[model samples]
Every structure is written in C-alpha cells, then in structure tokens.
Target: MDYMVIPDFVERKGSLYLRSDHMNYSRATLNSNWHQAREAEPKNYDINVFPKPPGRNLHTATYERIGHLKSKGLPNTTTKSALEQISLKPDFTERETRKSMVDVASFGHAIIDRELDAPSRGFGAVLPRHHPDYDKLHLETTHKADFTPPYPYDPAPERPPDFPDNSKAHRRYQSQFTDTADYRRSGRNTWQDESGVYGNTEDKRTVFPRTNPIPERLVQGLK
Candidate 1:
C-alpha cells in the first residue's frame, strides 16, 4: 500500500487525504465498497501483469483485512477473543509476493496504490438521518416563514431539483428576515457558514452573523 502514493509514502500514512471536492484522493471508510471484491477474490496471476493499467491489482493489505473478515462465524472460533490473526512475515511486499490480484473493476483495487471507494449508505441508511416520529425541523412546518414568504424574505435558491445531498437545503429553507443591508452588515464575509458538517472549507475562510427564520412563537410551539 505504501508504494502507491506521494512523498515519504509509507512513513506518512496520515498525511494523505481525499478532499471532499477532490476526487484525486479517496476516503476509504469501510469494507463494503472495495472489500466486496477483495474478500472473495480469485487467485493472483503468476506472470508479469506488468505495465498494468490503473485499477489493475488487488491491494494486499485490503485483501488481507477482508480475508480475515470472511472467516467470521466459523465453528472453532474462540469466544474469548475477537481478533483475527494475519501473518506478517518480514518478507511480503508487492515485489516479494510474486503474483498480484488483478482489479477487474477498473478501480485498480491495489491495497496501497489506488484510491478505493468508501462504503456507501445502504437500504436502511435513511433511518439514521431522520427521526420517524419526531417531525423534522423544517418539514411539516406550518410557520409562514417556512414557505416562500415574501421580499427581503425571499427563499434561498433551491439547491437543485433532486439536490442529491441531505434535504438540509429544503428544510433549512425559511423566509429571509431583515434587508440586504442587514445581510451585508451581518458579516457574511465568507460563504462558509457551518452549522455542522460542511463549515470546514479549504477555499477561503471567514464568518458572518446568522439569523434564524422561524418566528419565536413558532419555535416555542415546536419545542
């Protein structure tokens, strides 16, 4: 894995990153994404698969990790310990292993050499993002500001039709209060106003005063 990236590679594991907007690096979160292929992969080719195209080989460490996972729930396993053992002889490297597991998925799948996809949220994933019984802050809001109120209170642009991100945009949307002067003086010097996840911007950084749209009476009602 170490041989695939830039500068002081193996020694600098924490230095590399997959920027949120940067596709050059990948943030590999769990086994499902790349692990599916590595966990139950076929044999490594014995010959020189050389000058191989990108996404052409299985990453050794990833394969080893997933391989360990595949052995779960077997009969002889110990109840005392959950650790799965993998042999780490000093002699296993891409050069030493002699064969390489080829990545047929075009993502190369090399343990250390390529960027792998992180696990995606699955079928029941939406559950974590919302509360079934509790009304979402913005959805089901009958407050007048909750809708497209009026001037100086116009709605922010819809993120997009499907938006493709969290419904934060749709729900967080409320009638704007105050005038353009208030917006300007509110210190909205930067676009990066973070409520939670996305405030961390690598572009330019600054702050601004933010005003909530919900009328005080409505907020008390919801509470």
Candidate 2:
C-alpha cells in the first residue's frame, strides 16, 4: 500500500507540524527586534490614495455669523468705537435764529437783477435796419433768395416722334402690347407667314399639322 504525502504537513520526530508558506513569514515572526525596527520607521501616506478631511473655514464662518451688523441701523464698531446718537426733537428755533444773518444780495441775486434791467437777445431776435450788422445780414439773405439748384446733365433725353410724352398717353400706347397671349400668338403667326422668306419651313410644319381643318393659307401652308 502507498500513502500520499501532504505538501503542507511534515513528519518531524513522529509528530506532524504544519509548514507556513507565507512570503513575509520572517517579518511576521514574534521577535522584539523586528517589532522595534518597524515602530522606529516613519510612515508615509499618499494624499491621492488616503485623502484628508476638509476642516472648517474660519473666515466664511465668522463673516456669516456677523454679516447682519454691516447693514443700516445696526451697530458697526469697525470704523468708530463711539457713535453719536440722533435726537428725535423737532425744534425750529435754531432755523429762525439764523434767518436774519443770511445775505440777501448774493452773486446769484446780482445776476438776476442785471438780467432784469437789460435782458440779452437770442439769435432769432430781429435787428433794427439802422444797426451796423444789418447790411451784412441783408446781403446774405439776398444771396440765399437768388440761389437755384443745379440741373442733371441728361435731364431731358431726345425721344422718337411716335413715343408719347404724357404719362396717360404712354400708358395707353403700352396697353396695346400688354396682352401677352395675343402678342405671343401674333408673333408665332408672323413667323409662319414669313417662313418662306427665310426658306426655313421646318418651324411652320412642326407647329401646324396637315390635317388641320383651317385652309392651307390660314394654317400657314404647313403641307
């Protein structure tokens, strides 16, 4: 009989001992020196693998806590430590006391008095005929009154004797040819009539058939 030997078990002095195949068995041993050496070395950590926790922001937190004190009617102690409080009393005695000391003849008053005495004239105001500036103004006005706009180079081109000059007459003349169907039919008939003159009867023959009921002359002699 053959007995199978277990790879993980070893027979030492008739006692079976389990063998350890761990790669770091030496470091994992129960030795005081290995433990002390590992403890003495500083541990290094990667920020990408082991991220740090986000701590509280003191600036934003402080601003939010004291934000309401910056508005109106609230006590702002940054600029001034002691602030003057306003009185709600409505006494008019001080205004009346200083009324007499105010100057009545100021620069503005002088200007108003001067204008009232002799007012200034605007551009639209008419000048007297005897004034020295009236002659130049009269000359400029006369020149403007005599001014005339220039005419174009081809203002009136020569027209044919049969062409109508008046708008109504021109429209009436154009109305004779305005019927496009009649114009096209007449043009086609004229071409057929004069086809013999050009010695090209193909167009006429193609347009009018030999079995047409109309006379040959009326059908443009297609046959």
Candidate 3:
C-alpha cells in the first residue's frame, strides 16, 4: 500500500494539536490518493494508516481527522489500540516532536528524523508472512515503504554467501535474513588503531565494511 502520512503535533495548554496546514495537507493527499487508487485499481490498492506510537489521544485524533475527510469510508489504517499489543519501541510522541510547531515541517522530515537522526541504525528485520514476527516486521517495512525517499532505499539486498542452506528449512530461513546484513552497526570510534584506521585493530569486533567488498570474477568483456 502506498501514500501515507504520520501527522505532527504541538502541545499547548496541556493539549496536543497539529497545525491546520498539516491536517489539511494530510487530508488532501490522503483523500486524493485514496480515491485515485480505488478508481485505478480497486482490488490491488490498500490504504494502510500508521499513527505515531500515541500520547494522550493525539494518534487517534490524527487518524480520525483523515478518516472524516473520506466521503466513502476510511481505508485500512493500523489502529493505536492494536499497536499496543505489539511493541513499537521509541515512544513516538517524545522522540518525534520538534521544539516548536513551526519547526515541525513535512512528513518526509519527520520520517527522516525518526529513522536517520539516531547514532545507530534503526529497527529492522526480514521475516516470512507465516512467521510469528512477520506482522511487526511487515509493519516496520510498510511504514518506511510509503515514503519516496530522496535517496535510494533497498529493503531486500542480495542473499549473502556462507548462508547455511543445505536443508529445506535452512533455505526457507535464508529468506528471512536477506536484508539482515544490510543494517550494519556504525563503526566510527569503536574499533580504530593508533594510526586511526577503522577495523584495523586486533579486536576485530567492529570490522564491518560499509558495502559488499567481495570482488566479482573477471569475465570476457565485463569491466
């Protein structure tokens, strides 16, 4: 499902409120896309809403506003109450808000600040639809999937070598880890030699290359 928004808010007089523009914009985009998708391909397009993991009833209010905008009916949106059963850590309200309402910009900015602002890589996992962890994993994946990032974002990378897949179950399990290695831990100051060479020390605990370093075999005409 594509085209989604997680609204921003400002706390005033003990009540949290989103900007008029924010609500209007979100409603417009959502409604337009909602109708377009239904007309274009009613069967395939499914609108999935993901509210900021709640503070007070702000999450509910945000979704309610969008829901009200639709003349037909509200499409598929993940409810805050349903999310309570699942663990979506990093309290959205506290972590996602800006200093002032004016500072709270576009939905794109909010998503980037939520995922990329941190020192370490954010939450991720690849799991099959049948697995117990699949729902949560899919939730995280879908949240990020809706956004058309300025930079390229690949969810499933190529399967790595040395993956034990001799057995059928092992091969099935291999699918769950296609993107596992992509989310590498940042190796800035953790493992540096006196010469300041990263991953050059004997500890070997932080020897992670930023990208796949394996050299491809020379072919007849390939560079």
Candidate 4:
C-alpha cells in the first residue's frame, strides 16, 4: 500500500488535544488525542518513505543517534528512552521533536533540552549524559500547543454584591455606618486617609470599612 503520513498539526480544546500521528510510519492517523492514542500499538515505517517535513527531517548526525539508540537496544516504542534518544538528536529542533513526541503520545513528564544531573518530577524524556551539548541543556516545561497567558492584574470593584438583603440588622448597620459626621469628614479630606478606604468620588462608593458579610451571627454579635 502507498501509505500516507499525517502532518504535524495540533488542535486543542479544553483538556483534550487532537494531534497528528507520530509512529514513525506512513500509515497516516489524524486527530488522535493523547488520552486515547497512548494505549495503541507502536508503529514502524520506512525512514526513507516518510516525507521528512521541512524542519523534522533527520540529518546525518541525528540518524547516527537513532542508529546508536537502536544498537543500545532502545526499541522504537513510546518508552522514555526512545523519546529521549529522539530529543537528544541534532536533526530535529527542540520544538519540532516535542511536537513529534506529542503526536506519538510520547510526551512523557517533560522534555529535557539541556543537562539534567538529576531527574525532574513529571518529566519523561531526559537529555543524554554522553551528548556533546549536554552542558548547554536545561529543563523546559511541556505545555499544550495553544497554552494561554495568565490574566492581567485586576483589582476588585468597589461596589460589591455583599449587602443584598434589607434586614433589621442591615438597616441598623447602614444607618450607623453611612453618611455620618466622620464619613463626611473622611469624604471631604480623602487625601488625609492615604489608605484609600473611603475611595475616590469617581465610583461614588465608600470602599472603606469593607463590608464583611456574617449575617448568621449579625444580631448576636451586635448585641
């Protein structure tokens, strides 16, 4: 059969990701999610038959490394050693090798691009100790291809939804706390209160003396 090889395109939705096949085979399998693909059998393809994508083709040095791995009894399985052998090669860039690993469900705990004196937690593939570039290797986190950056700084709004009920205790506290001589004095000279508890006039809300809702014990504590 004239086999087809799947391209390394990934799509992530929520915790699940659909990836291209990475079995080193020409039997193209697309949209294989990690959670489901790892349980299947490993594949073997003619190294020459598979079209070496622009950045993923193995050069002479990398092919030698793979040959070395084979000589050392490291089979073309999804084992940690096999993945590491691939990662330590010079043919594929770190990013390209990592994507390939993910396609084959071989993204162990993490990918070690640099020297690793000790094994790191949650990392499956590690840098080879005898590698010429071992000194320059370092640990790197493996994240989803479409990982999102964290949210920016955001302070809570002044007018919160804490006081919703209009109960006797609420009314009593509101009357005693709102619009008093001290409140008016604080409002007029808000600059004096550097803590910004009373807040500015822009939002027109007293952000000071934060509203702590403990309605269950409100009456008991007030008495």
Candidate 5:
C-alpha cells in the first residue's frame, strides 16, 4: 500500500518535512555568509572578549541598605523629639485642665460659627452675576408693587352715559319676581305650614317632612 500510494497523497503527507528542510537550508546559507564576513574582518577574540562590566556593579547597595548605613551613625533626634512632645499621661491640674477644656470648647464653637457664616455653595451662589439674564432673576426674587392697570386714568368707559344707580337697578330687576302673583302665592314669609308640618310649604325652602301627621297622635302627645 505504501509503494502504491498516490504521489499527491505522499506530497501532502510530507508537507511538514519539506517546510522543515527549507527552513534548515535558509539558516545554513545565512550562517555560511556570516562566517565568511567574520573571517574577512578577522576580529580579535582576546581583546575585551567578555561583555564589558556594567558602568556600576550589579551588587551595589540597594536603597534599603543605603538608607540603613546612612542612618546608622546618626542619632535619632526626630524620635526623641516626638517622644518628648507627646504626653504619656494627661495633667489633671485644675487650672491647666480647665484651660484645655475651654480651648477645646472654643475650637468647636469656632468651627460651628465658621460653618454657619460661610457663603453657600449652592447653584444660586455659582450663578453668574454679570450675565444679561441676571437682572430678570433678581427682579423675580425681589418684591415689587402690585400690578396697576395700564390705563389707570381712562374714566372707565364713561359709565355708559345713562347707567342707573346700583340700588335702583337691583330693585327694578327684583320687581320681576316680587311683582308676580305666583311669587306672592308661594308662601315665602314662613318656614312651617298652618297644620304645623315643617318644610311642607309650596316653595320647599326646607327639608320635607318624612312622616304624615296624625291628628289623634298629635293630641295624645300634647296631653
């Protein structure tokens, strides 16, 4: 089966081997050219052959070591000063303690007063004062006189030239109802009827009586 394998199948199977051979050939060609160039120039391998030492030693002191060495010979004045300044126990002597308490109270009071007096940092505070619209905002915030009519002196349409007095006009209008016979017959004078039934009048000015009156029951209740 290997001998009878198709040529295309064999070529496809050996594609990786062919690619590796081509890469090796290219590498070998470049190496040969490099060797020839080196031989032509003939560089001396003995002269400073190893890489030059770094400008500074690789084992040079690190920051931690440098700081430790620098401070080793110096007296720790900073720590001593801090220790001296700090109070291990508060003094309860009456005058000193009272002064300290007063100072603390004053400090808190000063903070509160400063906060209260500080200018507000709200939107109104940041609004531009010089803007053209600022005047309109100021006007809106301020109180002004109530609006007067545009034509205050215009004599109110000359009063129709024949307008009647208000009392006379009202009486004339009321006469339409007061002068009618139906209005007179509607019993507008009293709230109760002659039979003592409340709100049973023709005009219905009050609530209607819910129960019919019994003469016998009324007489018995009265007795």
Candidate 6:
C-alpha cells in the first residue's frame, strides 16, 4: 500500500472522484490485506508499493501514454486522472483493464506509494500478504526463515530510524496512480479549461477528458 486516494468530502462529482487507481491486489487478497493492516498497526508494521518493471499489457501502454502526454506540457496527467475523467474507476470496473489492455501512458508503480497501514503514523505490524508476489513490508532488512516474500528482491534500502526489525516482511509492489484530474482535485479550475490552456486548441486537448479520448486523438501532441 503506497497511498490511499480518498476524495475530499466536499469535492464535486468530478473532483470528489478525486479518483484513485484500484488497489492492484486481488479482491480476496485485498480483503485479507486490509484485515492484516488493521490488526498489525500497533506493532510497527507498514505496507508499501514500488514501481513494477515495464513492458507488460495495459500497464505499459498507460505508462507510455503518460510519457507522451508529459512532453507536451501536460502538467498533471496521470493514470488515475485519465481513468476517472472517463468514469472508469479501476476499482469500479467489472474486470480490471490493466491486465488485458496495453497501457503505457500512466505510472504503474514507479512514481507513487500508498500508505497501507492506517492510524499510527501510517505504519502497521504483522502485515498480511494478499498475493504471493506482493511484499508485506518494505525490504530494508534480510528476511528471517519465517518471512515469506519471494527471494532475490532488492536486499538493501536505507532503513527508516523508527522501523523495527528492518521491515523484512513488507516488499513494495507496483503503483497505479497518476496526476490526471480525477485522481487529484486540487487544481482542476486552473488547468481544466478544456477549450485550451495555452490558448491553443491542440494543447488544451492535452488535458485528460471525461471519457476515453486517447484513441479519439483528442490531444494530438500530448507527451
């Protein structure tokens, strides 16, 4: 868990949609995970996410599209923003499109981190693992025989001063957030005058739309 994307209570439909990319863990797995965080918070545990490597399905395509959009001066374009603009909340989708589609326009796991453990300075204790691939805590120290993450992970991270036992149980996973409008509600009025920000129709299209505008060539020079 890197960061939970709860919308501001007063945010608008589009703004309150201050949307978040779905947590990537499987539904059943995610259930177990949240439970673990609830139980483990007092003992000094934390759940974190990391950037997944590139060149997969929709994740890659979204990542690529993000890069392209960034180059054209699209300041806040991100996967979460693009999806919410189209009313496509990853959590709400019947089936996750990330696994099936070729996405390269958004940040999958690289740019953001979610706070999994609630309360207690965003840390937890005795975290639960949803999927076999996900780590229970940050990998700042070596795993003991009881730890259960897949081996061959990055063996070293500068351990945080307050972290006890070096966080061997938690390993970071991929991120699904972006700077798109739906994901963040703070600056919409400033950058969302879709008619054009720079007074250029083409450039204004760079803004994420409220629908799937990527294939429509809505923003031609983005990224």
Residue range with the least summed lDDT across 10 consecutive positions in model 4: 167-176
* Residue 115 lDDT, candidate 5, scale 0-100: 43
Candidate 5 has its poorest 10 consecutive residues by lDDT at 168-177
lDDT of 3: 0.42
Clash statistics: count for each candidate: 6, 0, 0, 8, 0, 48
Q: Using Cα atoms with residue i matched to residue i, what is each candidate's TM-score against the true structure?
A: 0.11, 0.12, 0.11, 0.11, 0.13, 0.10
Candidate 4 wrongly placed segments (more than 4 Å): 1-214, 220-223
In the range 17-40, model 6's lDDT, one tens digit per residue, is 222344544223433245544453
Clashing pairs in 3: none
With a 3 Å backbone cut-off (N, CA, C), the pairs that clash in candidate 4 are: 109-122, 109-123, 109-124, 110-123, 114-137, 114-138, 115-137, 197-208
Model 6 CA deviation exceeding 4 Å by range: 1-72, 76-84, 94-124, 128-223
lDDT of 2 by residue, 61-116 (tens): 22222334444434556546443222333452355545443366554445432433
Compared with the true structure, model 3 gives a TM-score of 0.11
Best-fitting candidate, scored by TM-score? 5
Q: Tens-digit lDDT track for model 5 on 62-149?
A: 2322223544543547879789755744553345423344465577565433344434554455333454555574444223345655
* Candidate 4 structure quality by residue, lDDT tens digits, 1-223: 8879987455655523335545442334335554344333232432345565664445433232243355564445577667688666776555542335354456565574656665643355353344456588555556643464576567776766785432332222212234344454534443333333432332333333446677758768898
User: lDDT value for candidate 6?
Assistant: 0.43
Better of 4 and 6 by TM-score: 4
TM-score of 1: 0.11
Error of 6 at 125 (Å): 1.9
Report the Cα RMSD per candidate: 38.3, 25.8, 40.2, 33.3, 24.5, 50.3
TM-score of 5: 0.13
Per-residue CA lDDT of candidate 1, range 30-129, in tens? Answer: 2224444344455334122334556455443322233345555234447434443334443454565444455557445546533335323445442244
Candidate 5 global lDDT:
0.42
